[model samples]
Target: MQSMEGSNRTLVVTEFIFLGFSGVHRGQSFLFLLFLAIYLFTLVGNGVIFTLIQLDSRLHSPMYFFLSHLAFIDICYSSVTIPKILVNFLRQRHTISYNQCIAQMFFLMIFSATQCALLAAMAYDRYAAICQPLRYAHLMSRSVCVSLATASWTCGLLASTIHTVLSTNLAFCGANRIHHIFCDAPPLLQIACSDTYVNEMALHVASVFVSLGTFLLVVVSYIFILSAILRIRSNTGRHKAFSTCAAHLVVVIIYFGMANVNYNRPSAGYSLEVDTLISTLYCIIIPMLNPLIYSLRNKEVKEALRKVLGGLKKDSGLPQ
Candidate 1:
């Protein structure tokens, strides 16, 4: 956006160029193929899980309802960044229009924030099911689940709106090259021509609220969960209860660890390779790994997938 409404200086930056991996001296084609495969697999994996959840009535519980939304968010979240990454691999100079860059950043923020809150919600769900089994029914009823999900999404959107509004209003002057893979906030702020103190403040506040705050919620829930698990007199029962959250625990570790590394920084650093690698961890790798991670060791998900596959075979008149 360009503006000179009340100032003598002209601020013009209609688009930004991404130097994501353009500095890579070798094998752009290989990079493209690798990520393309990852992207397709990510979509197919999340899509299949999403469809299975929608079609299987057995999976209509509050937990699966949240799982469905998580799958949807993974699909959308990866789509927001991976496509641009793939495109950049084939072009000598990758560029995104001003409006497009802003839109990308907006969605990326929304999904990132929402996923943090959603993980907390899932943790709370697990806590209820395990620590308070007698009242789990009342604690995580349909209405209660809906309320939690709604609150997670509402907080995410509110936080993203505030950050995006603050970011786009900053003057970019003539600087338009983004060093990172995507239109992330830190990289964008690095090139701003105007004062960015207030914007940085808003970013830190939102990061604490969305990222650190939700992470603490998950941590506290897990503490209670661990205490409950330890109290079970039967060792097998204790192991079984802990196993239910094993997958979610793995995801929580990777997701929050990478998110903290990305957003908790004081400013954008100049190591392009390190930046791109970390970005890939959360944006592309985690989303692709989610469905398989959530389903591979889960008896319920495996059985549901088997039933769905069997139905498909019968519908197509293939051998039973």
Candidate 2:
């Protein structure tokens, strides 16, 4: 699709073509099946986690509260890109409307930014629980938890709004082919015919403020948490305290690591295949790993899962 600019008579793009899969001429079916399975797993995994947190009284706490938001974000984040990719695989022409691409980028930024804030919130929750047990209740009271969650979403909404509004104003009068797997800010900016100085600056500022800022918060929270853990004289106490934070730390490392690579890397000397792989890992695989990481590492979550499953079985009149 194309649109005419009034004075210059320039052809404006009404749709975008995805070139992420352009090099692949075969095994499209296999790729589709793999992504389909991953998407389904991401939904079920995050869904079960979200449901279990809501249903199980044992799982109700500030930590779990933040976790539920994370799970939901993961669901929304993967949904923004994966389904479109799936559909594109089935069609000969891999394309998305310009408006859809903008919307996709908007939601994608929202969820990713939200998850970063949520993870930092979770880290602070852990710090409160471990470093100040006596004050943990007051620190993470229901109201406080709600406020933190709300703030995280607000952060995402504000950041996404800035990027999306800026993105829509750019002129896509030349190539509309997005080089990356999805309609991300970087890929979209690369295709804009107009000067992207402001957009590029915004992206850089956001990378620092949103990504680096939240990451530093997590780091600072963990520093205090680790200090308190080390001061514990009892081996079991130290071990137990550390264990509470292990899964979150792992997730933070994986998330920030991939994000730094995906967004912060030098724009030069990167191949499309490399970019696609990193994006797939960052956007696609990370969400699926979150619930699994929590489930496998967390005894409470696993026990809750077992109980929930057992209850379902008992309700169905199956063997205990």
Best by TM-score: 2
Candidate 1 off by > 4 Å: 1-11, 268-270
RMSD of each: 1.7, 1.1
Instruction: List, residue by residue over 168-193, the lDDT tens digit for candidate 2.
Output: 98987768888887898988887788
Judged by whole-model lDDT over C-alpha atoms, candidate 1 comes out at 0.88
Q: Which window of 10 residues has the lowest lDDT sum in candidate 1?
A: 1-10
Q: Over the stretch 1-320, how does candidate 1's per-residue lDDT look in tens digits?
A: 57566547776899899876867758899999999999999899999888988988998877788888889999999899889878878788788888889999999888888889999999999999999989999999999999999998998799888889988898887899987888978889998989999988988898788898999999999999999998899999999999988988899999999998887755647488888888888799999999999889888888999998898899999997
The lDDT per prediction is: 0.88, 0.92
How much is the lDDT of residue 179 in candidate 2? Answer: 87
What's the CA RMSD of model 1 in angstroms? 1.7
Off by over 4 Å in 2: 3-6
Q: Candidate 2's error at 280, in angstroms?
A: 0.4
Task: State the displacement of the C-alpha of residue 206, model 1, in Å, after optimal TM-score superposition.
Answer: 1.0
